[model samples]
Target chain A: MIDPIDLQLIVAIQEGLPIVARPYKIIAGQLDLEEQEIIERLSRLKQQGLIKRLGVIVKHRRLGYQSNAMVVFDMPDKLVKQKGEQISQLAFINLCYLRPRRGELWPYNLFCMIHGKSRELVLQQLTQLIDSCALNDYPYDILFSTRCFKQRGAIYSIDK
Target chain B: MLSILHKQLLNNFQQEFPLSPRPFQDIANILGVSEDEVLSAYRELDKLQFISRIGPVIQPNYIGLSTLIAMQVPGEQLSAVASIVNHFPEVNHNYEREHLFNLWFVLIADDEHHLQTVITGIEGKTGIKTMQLPLLEDYFINLGFQLDLEDNHQSESVCT
Candidate 1:
């Protein structure tokens, strides 16, 4: 747990960091502290792993490229970690994970995000990447992102 | 002067709230604090990394577009290509996952043509081909992290 003063500082960072010249400076003024204090507290928070990163968010669908998919693989249990690392190294894969595999319904254990300009290009790379991995030895399926009902950032309200 | 109650007041804002002209007053009533107190605390929380942004997630498909693109960038060049992908505001969330495709990032644009232009731009800059995989269908849900309970595995073996 943190004291109220530090907690207040955290609250400000979470609510919204201003986007302007010297954003931290503006935040420091709002908190009635020096810029150095805001920077120090944020650095500590980041080091502690409470704060992941601070940056702008882009609305993807509104932009274009409008197709997104999650490709899952039924990777051998032995190769989970190694294979996950390999996939993560791909510049195109934004999200990658190793979920516990279920039965035939959810047989995929490895997941990666793939995006492209056209459907043809997306599939072409998919085939090539799989072929390179000799992934034919394993079973997989691609789950596309059809709709995004509610997508938001993390909430830090649990003080109990 | 201030204590845990203040923490509760700030976190509650990030979660669920009824937006009205006098939102601060309403929150003050619930937390048993003065309206000015709630407002002041809010300004403080904004200084910390506790909250990223406070706004409705605008739809992506409305104006421009986006795709969950994937690319298998060379490990040595992953960071370089990622920076290229992120140069445009079109890119939203990017991550290094555990898979063959090492780099993953979301690209949003004003239209399909723009998405393509961005992809081409990235390809030219990095000299690495991009695979844009758009989702076909989505089943099984939940995006936001659960706060009320422990990490209860859904579908018993679903991916994160």
Candidate 2:
């Protein structure tokens, strides 16, 4: 459980982490604690695997990359584990997962995403993988992202 | 103060930052700037992204509540479909990845059943099958990024 002080520190960090000489130090200053305390808390959180990362969020569309596709492949239940592993290993796969197919309304079993500079390039890569897997026999669909509403990381707090 | 070069360095921080102490300094050294500058630059970047970040991008499972809902929309009913999905604020993420199940969104419902009920309700109203994939397990890192870039998931983990 987070005490009030920790919660306050968390709130400030959630609002924004400082950017400079020593970020934790700056955060600590805001929270009225020592930098070491902030660092120590983060370390503990890391050990518990609560906090995930500290990094940058880059804008992709503005960078002029052309295409993105949601490639759904129909792999047999038996081969799903093997194929999913293989797909996940590829460098270009930003996101990949397998979901059970629904009633006739939907029939695709596995879903994976491949990204590249353009739709053509992404499609070319998709063709190679689809053909190589001989996955044409199974039913599937491809839906490219038309819009994005929220793409930032999920913010969390102890209070529900 | 951050120089233009340091800002450029933040542009290159990427999804996976190399693990090291004085990590920002390491970046500064590579970019020909002082550690202080790199530190400050990170703050500015965090402010822009609306979260604190650095190291260990936590898997979605770590914070709990995750599900994927895919709905097939009649070509003409797309707007209505989106409005229905948008009704629930828990639908933190809505996307248009390429596929026949054209509309995909992440629903952070109170639980798995809640996620299913919403999808089912949508399907009942629209008559198209809605595939609800409650994340079974997470081993693959799937997050959309940009041209030659993967989005940085390092937001502050108020995971306490």
User: Which tens-of-lDDT digit does each residue in A1-160 have in candidate 2?
Assistant: 4456655655566534444545677777777888778777766654565544445554344334435677876778888877777777666676778777776766767888765667787888887777766666777677777666445445545445
| Chain A superposition TM-score per model | 0.78, 0.73
TM-score of each: 0.47, 0.72
Runs in model 1 with CA error above 4 Å? A1-160, B1-3, B6-11, B136-144, B148-160
Stretches of candidate 2 off by over 4 Å are: A1-16, A26-34, A40-53, A131-138, B1-12, B15-23, B36-56, B97-100, B113-130, B141-160
Encode model 2's per-residue lDDT on B18-57: one tens digit a residue: 3343557778788887887676666665555422355335
DockQ values, each candidate:
0.03, 0.29
The candidate scoring highest on DockQ is 2
In the range A36-132, model 1's lDDT, one tens digit per residue, is 7777776665455444333323223322334566778888878877767766655455556655554544466677766654467567767876876
Worst 10 residues of 2 chain B by lDDT: B151-160
